[model samples]
Target: MSALIDRDEFPLLARAPELVYLDSAATTQKPRAVLDALRAYYEHDNANPHRGAYALSARATERYRAARERIARFFGLADADCAIFTRGTTEALNLVAASWGRANVGAGDEIVVSGAEHHANFVPWQQLALERGARFRICELAPDGRIDLDQLRAMLGPRTKVVAFHHVSNVLGTINPVREIAELAHGVGALAVCDGAQGAPHLPVAFDQLGVDFYALSGHKMLGPMGIGVLLGRREVLERMPPYMMGGDMIEFVHDDRSTWNVLPHKLEAGTPNVGDAVGLAAAAELLDAIGMDRVRAHEQALVRTAYERLSAIEGVHVYGPAPDARSGVVSFTVGDVHPHDLATILDARQVCIRAGHHCAQPLMRRLGVAATARASFYVYNDESDIDALVAGVRTAKELFGHATV
Candidate 1:
């Protein structure tokens, strides 16, 4: 077994040494730096960020702005003001659908999305197209669970106003070709929107180089706190859109009859922002940058390779997605005749934590011809020991179910 990561940095892992945590695609365990940053914010710099005139408020505002800049830099975004804070990736995608989709997509227009999208990315565009009288088209996936680019190209036309797709499938762990996809959309004069919730956590994403108009990311998936995410958009596109939520912070001037909106990102962010979580996310980004995303990706890749090789050798274990090199750290599979939930419960008894069911990608599940799957996802903290534990737990489940080995 490979040596484990320094669990001491994450108190949860440190406390539970016996537990095997393989559900990182759902949410990662936070580092102490992130927790300390959150605590320090409330202890020292807790104030309404943009509206106050006092010292604490000024300090709070500075930190909040610094957090935004730090996150933007992490994603290789040139314009810091293009990073708009949202509750999470769900809210970020919704903001795009409501603000950009409403104005840009007219009757008879088309919004293209992939079947591999999480419900967060899928439902919003579908509903937005329904509301706007636009056609919501699904880009079919290849047999290997990748976006069928030929089909996507055939679907894109002059009426294709927007194209939305996940940079990495949360269920299949298939890494979509973002640059190529964005180029396809741009060729058709359609704006590309990438759901980066999975990609941001595990890959080094250069937003400027991706050629996408907008990318959505979540903090909690990247060793940060919950309730904080970012919608990094092109400044030109964002400036043309309307405010997502009309409220106190997003206003420039409040007339009794009509109120003007703020500039750039502030126009998109409404109400008191999640300042504390934003700080936490910044600290998380700092931690990732310090370690380097390339190293993190390599680490997860090693885990996936080890896990995939070992699990695929087992009888009746049908692993999904591309090979380890082509995918992220996630591995989804189903054992013969054993339900995913039942298998998950058995694994839990062995102190192995995994995810089960549709993983919020019901369309992908249906495409795979399965009701659900048992998924084991890796992160920096996971090692071969975790994979071994999961394998043993699966064997135990097979034994208990009286399944014969090949």
Candidate 2:
């Protein structure tokens, strides 16, 4: 483990000495800075925004807008107004499905999603397609758990209105070529929508560079507070799309008879928002920026490489996903004769927290021919000691399962 980052920088890790938090793919542990930000917001600025002209309200509104700017800059978006805040990645996807899909996708039009998408990314499109009489097509995954580019090319056509897929597989950990996929979607006259819930935190992402129509990411999974996510799209696209919700704040003019809606971001963010969570998310983004995304990527890649090598060395452990070079920070595997749930329990007993089960990617699990698997995901705070604990926990689990060593 490199001594680049001090344990004191992350209070959660510092306090929880026995806890090996390896489930970052699910939700990351909040850093001290983020928690402090959340505390400061609630303790001081507790006013509802965009309504009152009071000092508190103005401060709240300023904080909210600044959070948007922070997140927009983090993603390399051109305009902060283009980023709409939501509950989380699930809500972000649903907003796009309701707004963009309703306006653009119609009967006989096709929407393509990869088979490896989490249910958050899959069900919204599926439900929308059912509602609009649109054709829902899935891009097949290769044996190594990447999108089959040949099949993607064949499946896309003139009628394809939207291509929604994960930038990184939540289950397989396969990093999709966003630029290539976006270009392919454009070739078929389709809008490329990327589910960045799994990608944004681990990898450096540029919305403009990827040429994506929309990108969704969760705050909790990126060491920020829960209940806040971002949906970044082109200003033109969001301006044309209808609001997902209707209420005060998102209105231009209103009467008993009719009303006009607010502009880009406010239109989508209806009702009172998760202001504190958004502030925490901005702080988290700033922390990530300070560390530098390239360094973060390098640290995670090193952890993943170390994890893959160590886990693969253990007998009866079947690892999933592409090679370490092809994947990011996730490692999903199953041990022989031990149920994933059982393995998870044992690891938990050892204070080695890992995610088990389908990980909200049931379709991908079906493709992998498993009901569940144990997944260990690394993050910026993780080090080789964490990986060693995971490997040891798995070995102990296998031994408890009474498997013979080869």
Q: Which candidate ranks first by lDDT, i.e. highest?
A: 1
Residue 201, model 1: lDDT of 95
Mark the regions of model 1 whose C-alpha exceeds 4 Å error after superposition. 1-5, 404-406
Q: Enumerate residue pairs that collide in model 2.
A: none
**Window of ten residues with lowest summed lDDT in model 2:** 1-10
Error of 2 at 82 (Å): 0.2
lDDT of 2: 0.90
Q: How far out, in Å, is residue 158 in model 2?
A: 1.4
> What's each prediction's clash count?
0, 0
lDDT of 2 at 15: 89
Which 10-residue window in model 1 sums to the lowest lDDT? 1-10
> How far off is residue 183 in model 2, in Å?
1.1
Q: Tens digit of lDDT per residue, candidate 1, span 35-86? A: 9999999999999988888999999999999999999999999899999999
